[model samples]
Target: MLIRNKALFNKGLMLMGSFLCVFVSLFLPIWGGHGNGLDAADNMFNRLSKGSSYFIPGVKEDALKLEGKSVTITVKVKDAELAPRAVENLVKAGATAEFKDGAITYSGDLGKVLGAALIDADDLFNNRGPAVLERYAATEKNAEKTIVKAWWAVLDPSIKELQKQKLIQEAKVVGQVNKRGLEPGYNFYGINSEKVLDNVLPLVGLLAFYVLYTMWYGYAIFDMFAGIGLGMSKPKTKSEA
Candidate 1:
């Protein structure tokens, strides 16, 4: 085939090189929230996403000794509409969730569950106006009033302190990383189809180079073959006869 049609064969080789360039460009990895300078935050998200359970030196033993059994931390929010959403959020963040008695039952590590429940419940009310959230926080609606179920009391202050310090966004991303209703492109650490598109641009550049090189090399070879054919077809000189 090469002898019969050198030009066509060279063009075919150039076209094939373009595919290689596109393949690599689209799949190149880029930094993401999972490990892109967010490992601690990401780990927190994973832990909370599984369940807020954690090991304290003595809390588990104390709960066994004092409470007479394993205790399930729970809370009730005032808004019925937001209550169900908060329950769903808790479940996604890795805790057991049930809606009962106008409340959310989240059985997990107290601090972790406490943080998620409080932050998320209020997140539902965030749009009503800052004044409304301010009233909720000021009144301590985030805590269970009874001391016996006060497993979450400590986190109440800590969360407020963070809010006081204006670390609200960082404070919540731990659980928010795995929440529903995220922005369309908020893919945590997973590579989305959009990222694959970025790779396409790189591949296009590589394929361009490949195509250009193939065209030059193919033309050179084809031109050389054509010259040989022309010489062979010429009539014999009189001197040789």
Candidate 2:
């Protein structure tokens, strides 16, 4: 009887040990890794989005919010000759252009007149090619400035159109006018800690349940074996004993 009890106790212990090993090896690590990975991803995206907004400045606002206001146009011209012509054209149409460093700026009320002026400038650049552009360069170094100038030249018309349609008011053109690009950042719409936790909590719960179930299964199996051993070790009967 004593021997049988000892055997039963050992079997129970073995079952429990097996359950713990399986539970820890399979479910616990997976649960941990999954939760951590999700957290890291959310954090990364949040940082990227915030950084973009900070660096780009004013990108968070609607594009059409600037409609009907006075604006300043800045450009970098490589060709000195084209610069004069560009400035002359702008001045003739009641828009002012000034050159400082290597850039030209046209500042005025962004009304229909300015818009029409931009359109005419666009046509001149598009149709005349390099020949018309060559006349504007003051030095050989300015030759390379054509592309950027042409780009600004083209954008003028679009800005004017936007003004006419009341899409954007009071515009400021900075950087290379022709080289328009998005500011750096991420623009995720609806991500928050609560949302992230909601998605992850279920996996964690499942893992806990699995661990508990494994432990219980081990105990149950041990109990069954112990009961069987106890029954077998009982004396047969009075006569036999």
Candidate 3:
């Protein structure tokens, strides 16, 4: 190929080579405590995400309104071993629970039952899995799955029964606790918490790098094209009458 602009060509080569170097560095284990650049960025975002998803406090407010509301429901436990643990959790929450035939018939004030769930969800959200296990008399093996899963099994049906009893607000509170509390807690269990303010610098840096890197590639291509005599030019207008 004929060399049209040697300086532009060399600049492109330099930019592209440097860009490639940075790209390869992303996979290297350089970020302390969080593996590579990719992993570190993902970890940072996960922590920030978990930090932002704390909705337990609002749900608790909703539950407080239903403090004296009463509910009675029998939820069948698919896992027989978890049945007793589920009953224990209910009883500990100031509910009367009878475990028979792999189903737990529980009765209590609506607020206390939901409050207990919120406590468990908060613990799990804060990465306190052992606290939940201990609360439910559960062992470490499959601890989170066994305990959290049991809570879900019981609460899910209780919400349905509450709806059947026309306790709409009460049911909504439990649903919110499950969605905003338990799910996030379970999903983001092991991630370290990071506030957005604490990570403002790095977060902004990553976003800025993303924008610059995209432009970096575009300019590299443009420079290379210009060096090869492929630059666009404004068309000359015909001399008028």
Best by lDDT: 3
Better of 1 and 3 by lDDT: 3
Q: Taking the tens digit of each residue's C-alpha lDDT, what string does model 3 give over 1-241?
A: 9869999988887888888999999999987875998998888899999889989888888877878888888877767787876777788889999988767899999788888878888888888888888777677686865556667768877777778888887888888877887788778887788899998999999999999999998888888889999888998999999
Q: Residue by residue across 1-241, what tens digits does model 1's lDDT show?
A: 2245566544545554554454444344333443432353344444333232222222323222322111254455544555554554455445677778865555544345434443333233222223333433434452212111121322233334445556564334322322321211122212212232445564465569668766665565555565444323567678864
Q: Score residue 20 of candidate 3 by CA lDDT.
A: 90
TM-score of 1: 0.21
- Residue 217, model 3: lDDT of 86
**Which pairs clash in model 3?**
none
The lDDT ranking, best first, is 3, 2, 1
* Between candidates 1 and 2, the TM-score winner: 2
Taking all chains together, the TM-score of candidate 3 against the true structure is 0.78
Clashes of each: 3, 16, 0
Q: What is the C-alpha RMSD of each candidate to the true structure, in Å?
A: 18.8, 18.7, 3.6
Candidate 3 at residue 50, lDDT? Answer: 86
**How does residue 9 of candidate 1 score in lDDT?**
48
Strongest candidate by TM-score: 3
lDDT values, one for every candidate: 0.39, 0.46, 0.82
Q: What are the per-residue Cα lDDT tens digits for candidate 2 across 1-241?
A: 2345665676776777776675566543353535443454445456444333332223213222332555566666555556665665556546777767866787655453334333333333233324334544434543323433543453444455445545443333422122222211112222221333444565466568668876688575756567456443556676764
